[model samples]
Target: MTISNHASVPETIALPPKEFSRTLYAYVVWGGLALALLWSWAPAEMDRVTYLFSDSGNMVEYASGFLTPNFHDWDYYVQEMILTVQIALWGTVLSIFFGIPFAILSSSNVAPIWIVQPVRRLMDACRAINELVFAVLFVVAVGLGPFAGVMALFVHNLGIIAKLFSEAVEAIDPYPVEGIRATGASKLQEIIYGIIPQVAPLWISFSLYRFETNVRSATVLGVVGAGGIGQILFESIRGFYYGETAAILIIVVITVTVVDLLSQQLRKLAI
Candidate 1:
């Protein structure tokens, strides 16, 4: 009798054993201990010693007097606000102009290591100094005005925008750039033809975000005598003109909210 030929069957390989439950338990234990340690450090006695919430009536009184808000000084608020808007706009434009080139030069794929690393380090160093610190420094240097505020926003934002733009460049897909290079395109041409199109949306989005942030920052720059709505707000609060402070706060809150909403809509349209 002849037997039919058949191929030998392959054995199934076992999957490595998993310790999912054990790993989950470890995470839970770590989280609980961390929370417990935080809670223990913040003693209940510390809260009582501080007058933070000692008298609820004091807070209620302040709120009642100030929360109503007096917009009778609307004209002054509007003028300072216009100056604040100007500072933010100028700052954002300067940031975008300087930042894009720095980002390109600092990117590894775009620039050689010798060039890229130095530019990156410089940008990081610039960004390490806080915007408010720069504002204070510039205010001192320029003798206090909107120009000081503008310069503060310009330097700080130049660094920040550069970092963000470089990150965007690094995160891009390499295929398009490769394809362009394959066509005998130079490095700059490859970037201009292939990478820029993909990165433009993200770059614009970051710029808008910086613009909104600059607006808020420009407001406070005045408090240091750089000149903006912050100076008005600070003086009013110092003199115990609580109603005036409330009105200024209302104006600022409304303006910022509008900018935020507009930016959101623009981003949506962009995407």
Candidate 2:
């Protein structure tokens, strides 16, 4: 045991080899994306890239008309803008009312597979169709008014709200729900006490966000005779009253900005 002036060397551990499957998967994903773009390029008119530069004068002349907005009918514009907001309010409220039950039914953690599958498929159908298409149909049924717009938004947003809320429900901490069940609480009671409390903040935030989106969508619904400022805006555009179009667009921008700000503040409070 005499001092052996030697230090023991640590073993060199080898790292596992990188998997070839991951690299192949990455290449497949990128190749698929490239193929999609290539396939659509001609149909999408990718060859017209030089047209913007060549036709710059026409764009300038068209855009110049919007530089001076005519607010002569400012009162009417404000009134229609308010009506648009009202449409969004009613639509969002109705969606929230109907979406709650659908959300619960669609949630995998809350409902049985038999119920969840059908409810989710229904929601998928609702979500797949655009609100504009729904607006067109409702206009036919309701005879062209804000009511049609309300129904359109309500139907489309119901699907969206349910999807958002179900996702929130699925992600909830299961401990509280388990505790409620342990206390001999019924299924509905467990959901009401445990699930609702956990997801309330997120649900409120989602609803507010949808309300903001609905406001913007409501503005366009008027084009389909669903009523609101979008009808007037479309008229101005069709009539080539560029000044009036500019004024209406300005009002829309301001209203959307204000709604966005208010919703953001409310979301902060909710969280």
Candidate 3:
């Protein structure tokens, strides 16, 4: 009797039977169609740029030259680079200063419908414009330098900080906030004593992430004549001084890597 029961094994459904394999074929067909469309539709954007593929020799020569660099004018780089760091450091600090409050105001638990709705909308408007666009306009108005980059970083970081801080606020322990209200604590006191502590570390971690991002952004902003190593890079590309361009790129990679690693360490600590 036991053997008979054992012999009648439980039937198991295949986790992925033959029918599921058809999905892969569907993707294959979809991908083929996409490639065909891309090939047939030579985009207008591509037509505008002087694509290097058409001039293969020049591209090769430039890339080869970029492998070797002359850093004799490294002294000049020191001054301009300091300003870039300053822009990023200041932006990160200033953004956090004001953004934390907005985050609290925009969070549903901490704020009323009238406050949260308008504040969230305002944050959205701030985020709509890219940092580079802000820098471009400022460059035209304020003249070419770090000051314009500062203003650009400030506005962009403010929006980013606000958004992240609000999310952090939303994710906090609701029990604490509720408990504080029950004990006769005022709204401000409850936020100060109960809510802020829970999420402050996360806010710091987010700010560090934003700082790392801004450092990279600051480099690109210089390409549009804002300021930093990208200015040097832009000049190298224009003058066919590929060697200097390569050195600038190396420096940028090191800068970004260091900032990224430091942020990672901070994140671990915060967590």
Instruction: Give the top-scoring candidate (lDDT).
Output: 2
> Looking at model 2, how many pairs of residues clash?
0
Q: Stretches of candidate 1 above 4 Å error?
A: 1-50
Separately for all candidates shown, the number of backbone clashes (residues 3 or more apart, or on different chains) is: 0, 0, 0
lDDT of 2 by residue, 152-234 (tens): 99999989999999999999999999999999999999999999999999999999999999999999999999999999999
Clashing pairs in 2: none
- Model 1 per-residue lDDT tens digits across residues 204-231: 8998899999999988988888878989
Q: Estimate each model's TM-score.
A: 0.83, 0.93, 0.81
> What TM-score does model 2 achieve against the real structure?
0.93
Give the candidates in order of TM-score, highest first.
Answer: 2, 1, 3
Best by TM-score, which number? 2
The superposed Cα distance between candidate 3 and the true structure at residue 131, in angstroms, equals 1.1
Q: Write the per-residue lDDT of candidate 3 for residues 1-271, one digit (tens) a residue.
A: 3667555666885565567679889989999999988786676455645676878898888678977876766666656666677778877788789888888899987899899999988888777889899889889989998878877888887888888999988899989888988999998989998888999888878888899888888887787777776677778779977777777777778778988998899888877
Error of 2 at 195 (Å): 0.5
